[model samples]
Target: MKKLRVGSVLLAGIVAAGAAWAHGGATGIVKERMDAMSDIGGQMKAVGRMLRAGSYDPALVSSAGATIAGHAGKTLVDLFPEGSLEAPTEASPAIWTDRAKFRAYSDELQEAARAMKQLADRGADMQEVAGAFASLGGTCKTCHEAFRIKK
Candidate 1:
């Protein structure tokens, strides 16, 4: 189909673009943050899948929450040193310009993740864990919306 061919080409172009800028090739703070953010996204997805399945494992959720909370706020900001937006960075200039707001989003993420971790640690039910997870995801969504460049 003509439409399918056009869509496939577009997909390949996007894949090739990211491969060209492979995060490994990017050295310094850019790579560090890229890896860290990738880990965060992975952990979030793992926990999200568990929560969605309704067969959640509390310990695993707690562990993922700890990992996310550990990298929130200051941990995130420290990785983004001045002018670290070289290549393979989703960061936007708006982050540096609106540093306070960005920091707030980081803090929000930490708070939400910590809350979720606490609930999971206490052997809370799926409902409680899901609520906290939603809060944490909200912070991520909010931060990405404002700071991340759609690549």
Candidate 2:
């Protein structure tokens, strides 16, 4: 009877430890956030192409910009942590090695996205909107150049 109780306690402890470890293993989190970001990228590209063709509705452009801001603000930072560098995670060890710079890129992305949302919300004139869009694209390019690996 005593042996059975001890074995049960050991099993419970093992299960709890596993759950804790799994939470810290963020490879899937990174992948999911990256995929979501890519979806936003594709949407942004579509909106830009439409704008270039002079057929893009301002409403649609604002909607896509809002979506990007929302996702980038909420999900981008949560994806990176101390142990996020794993296979299928293009997140380089440099992310963990150079934590400050990594965090700066993340902050810059969020800040840019927020600025985009503000510009989009204000329904500014097309020239201002186009310049804001360009600035947002520049932010993406800056971060990608620093941390993200190109496929």
Candidate 3:
């Protein structure tokens, strides 16, 4: 329980940090991707809040996981085309240069989210769900570190 709380806090901090980036000037595909990412972050925050509050609702977890899976993988990769880096966009050129790696990260996120959904659907315990959430957050952190430009 302690570990879960700590992990939730860390993930919340990461999501909050990303939220600090200004998306007001983003347009077109950049804005679309940003909006998608914001949705994902919102789900993560919602789940984290529930976990921290010890209100582990499997239904909510499953729904959130499904939402994340829907937005990830190919859906995420498609948002980045060649040289679509408009101002206020945080995507790194490495996303295109290391396309395979970026795709791999997207796939990982999708897989992690799917796993979480499966666990929730099976009515898994809080510890198990929290672990899956932590894995999901780790994937997001890894991808951001590799492909996002901090401002």
Candidate 4:
């Protein structure tokens, strides 16, 4: 379980790094989504750092989760208009071709973040909160594998 959790966190870190890299030279809506993704990555890194340092701050974790939730779901979907694949966008065309699946992934991410926020807000144990964080990271990895284009 510990190994699995560590792998999940590493996968999310890679995906977030890719997202940050893809934002370079992006413009318009493409830039918007990239910027949002970068923000999410920043939040993930912060939480990951706290977790690694054994500094379990429930309030900070909850706030990070809430911020991720706000940027996910419909907001995420709206950022990707059909054929908006401008230069530097790491969004795969599969997003438009498989719209429903893309939306489902976005919704899943939002749900996972919300669950994490709830767990943190309730003062869950470190293991419980970390599990929620791992679950959220897994969702991000899965979605990126399916919908993101590697640069």
lDDT to native, each model:
0.75, 0.59, 0.89, 0.84
Per-residue alpha-carbon lDDT of candidate 1 for residues 1-151, written as tens digits (9 for 90 to 100): 1122123233333233334333567778888888787777777777766654557699988998899889888999888776678866879988888999988998998888899999999988777777787667778778888998977
Q: Which candidate is the best by TM-score?
A: 3
What 10-residue stretch in candidate 4 is worst by lDDT?
A: 1-10
Mind giving the per-residue lDDT tens digits that candidate 2 earns over 1-151? 1122123233333233223211133347776766666666765665566545455367766777767776664356667767766655555666677777766766666666666557767876555555566666666666666776643
Error of 2 at 80 (Å): 1.4
Highest-lDDT candidate: 3
RMSD of each: 8.9, 20.0, 1.9, 3.0
Quote model 1's TM-score: 0.82
Local lDDT at 27 for model 3: 90
Q: Candidate order by TM-score, highest to lowest? A: 3, 4, 1, 2
Lowest lDDT sum, 10 consecutive residues, model 1, at 1-10
Give the higher-lDDT candidate: 2 or 4.
4
Q: Candidates 1 and 2: which is better by lDDT?
A: 1
The order of the candidates by lDDT, greatest first, is 3, 4, 1, 2
Q: Provide the global lDDT of candidate 2 against the true structure.
A: 0.59
lDDT winner, 3 or 4: 3
* lDDT by residue for model 3 (19-134), tens: 55558988999999999999898888888888877878999999999999999999999999989899889899999999999999999999999999999999898889988988
